[model samples]
Target: MFGDLMGMMGKLKETQEKVEATKKRLDTVLIDEQSTDGLLKVTITANRSIKSLKIDDALLEDKEQLEDYLILTLNKAIEKATEINETEIAAVAKDGMPNIPGMDLFK
Candidate 1:
């Protein structure tokens, strides 16, 4: 029993290290996708928050349309960020505890 407890503690420590490494890897990856025409660009953090947005002034001629496009593009960016998070969570869970059901406690 003591040996098993020690093994579990070792596994937990390894998992914590992997989680930190994964976060660092994600931090370097850019989720900055832009509109098709490049009129709008959005940068999102690894944790799914908007870091910044750049809009070309040329799109402002049609203010309403620009507004709508901005909304749409930001939504797309948000979705992309969420997908990244899901992928990361799954990867970490699978790496750490492949045999457990619903092991995504880190997300």
Candidate 2:
């Protein structure tokens, strides 16, 4: 019983290390997305931090449209960042808990 407990603790430590590594990797991962009309572009890190934004000069004439496109493009970039974050975390979980049966269900 003590051995099993130690093994579980070891696994937990490994999982925590993997999670930390994933977070560091996420800081460097970025997602870029643009509005449907290609007027606005947004770049966000996997940690959901906005790194940069770009807008076409033509869209500057309409403040309302520009705001709308900015919101849309930002949301798209954030969504992609979330997907990448989840995937990386799931991979860490899988790698750290390989001994668990049916663990793929968590992924």
Candidate 3:
């Protein structure tokens, strides 16, 4: 019984390592979003770190419009990044999980 417990513990440790690695990898995964009018463009990592922002000169003419565009575009970018991040992390975690009796019920 102890042997089985030890093996399960080891598997859990391995899964944790894989999950951390996957998170690091996600930092390089980029998600790009642009405003509907194509006036503002944003690039962000799956980790939700902003990589770059490109704005059209037209947007600079109005402060309020620029803020609105920025908010909308950034929100879209964040949403996409969050989805990718969660899916990737979940896939890694689920694949690494060791099969245990009754665990399938949670799925």
Best by lDDT: 3
TM-score ranking from best to worst? 3, 2, 1
Q: Is candidate 2 or candidate 3 better by lDDT?
A: 3
What TM-score, over all chains together, does every model reach?
0.72, 0.87, 0.94
- Worst 10-residue lDDT window for candidate 3 reads 98-107
- Among all windows of 10 consecutive residues in model 1, the one with the lowest summed lDDT is 98-107
Clashing pairs in 3: none
TM-score of the candidate numbered 1? 0.72
Pitting candidate 2 against candidate 3, the one with the higher TM-score is 3
**Candidate 2 lDDT tens digits, 1-107:** 78887997999898999899899999999888998787888888999999988889999999998988988888888888999998999888877774655556664
lDDT of 2 at 42: 86
Which predicted model would earn the best TM-score? 3
Return the clash pairs for model 2, or none. Answer: none
lDDT of 1 by residue, 21-99 (tens): 8877776666897889988999986666678888898887998979888888888887887788768966875677533
Measured on C-alpha atoms, candidate 2 has an lDDT of: 0.87
- What is the Cα-based TM-score of model 3? 0.94
Full-model lDDT for every candidate? 0.78, 0.87, 0.93
Candidate 2 TM-score, C-alpha based = 0.87
